[model samples]
Target: MNIIEVEDLTTTYNGHTAIKNISFKIEKGEYVCLIGENGSGKSTLIKTIVGINKKDSGKIIKNIPPEKISYLAQNNMIDLNFPATGKEIIMTGVQKHKCLPFYKKEDYKKFADVCKLLNIEDIINKQISDLSGGQRQRIMLARALIRKPDLLILDEPCSGLDVNITKELYNILNKLNKEDGLTIIMATHDLEEIKTIGVRVICLATTVKFDGDIKDWKGEM
Candidate 1:
């Protein structure tokens, strides 16, 4: 089943075209990667798909529920001194209504399960500001998983992490895609990590340059 279909999608900023015309389809439970150099419309395409930036033309058909699609951007700009615990930050993902006065017991249980699944239980009580860079990334991932999103959209998920941590994150993502059958669409420039994850690769150089098995990338910039 096609979870997302984009036809002739285009985006412009101040009359400058970011993505000329692009088309693609993401299947259910498929792990797809969006690759391109900087200023090559990778981020524009993602923003357009997620509705952060309005497209200039074409169509974006999302068959999945809006809430079921979670987007984790490169820079997660949350205040460092917000005074929120890691668990609380994660629970925010599961909270549907922002105005809700209290969290139910089931919500807490779900949060705990997600933490355990991401191996972030030890940092649950720690403040978000006190965690390491890799730990913070894991916490953000746990928060995304707490909502049980059907389609996960990640932009440069392993940007600042060390090689070892990047490998660990890839392992978790691969497990999530294979074991839980979650559909993942990630935009990244990490070629090595891409090879390790072994997903379908979609290279966007202002348009759909390549889309196929990652093993066949050919290293063609």
Candidate 2:
């Protein structure tokens, strides 16, 4: 099944074209890596797919509803000084579907399951500011997963992390995609980092430069 289909998509920011005439289709349960140089429209394309930015032209057909898709943007935008606990942050994912401010027993249980899967159960009570970069990323991922989304979109998820930590994060995402059957589309410039988990590669340079299996992507890096 095609989870997302973008046909000749174009997007602009303040009248400046970001991505132009890009087209692609994301299949169900596929792990796709969006790669390109800086300001090459990788972020712009995914943002358009996720509906974060409006497309200036073309059509986007999403098999899943907007609410069923979970997104993790480029950077952690939450205030580090915020006193919210890990659990509190994760529970916020359920707020969109809730009529009350408080979580029910099942909501708490789902949060616990997601925490255990992410291996952050020990820090559930800890403040977000107290965790390491990796731990904090995991918390954010857990929060994204609390929605049980069919499609997971992440933008430059490993922007400022060491190689080892970045690989660990990919392993977690691999498990989620391979084991749990979640379709994932992540944008990153580091091709080496995705060598282990990348099933498909979509290289964009303000357009569709290449779109094929990872092994067939022959562009010079």
Q: Against the hidden reference, what TM-scores do the models get?
A: 0.94, 0.94
lDDT against true structure, model 2 = 0.86
- All candidates: CA RMSD (Å): 1.5, 1.4
Predicted candidate 2 versus true structure: per-residue lDDT over 24-134, tens digit per residue: 888899999988888888888878887779999999999988778998875466687899998888988877767777878988888988988888989989998999877
**How many clashes in each candidate?**
0, 0
Q: State the weakest 10-residue window (summed lDDT) of model 2.
A: 72-81
In order, what lDDT does every prediction score?
Answer: 0.86, 0.86
TM-score of candidate 1 against the unseen true structure:
0.94
Please list the residue runs of candidate 2 whose C-alpha ends up more than 4 Å from where it truly belongs after superposition: none
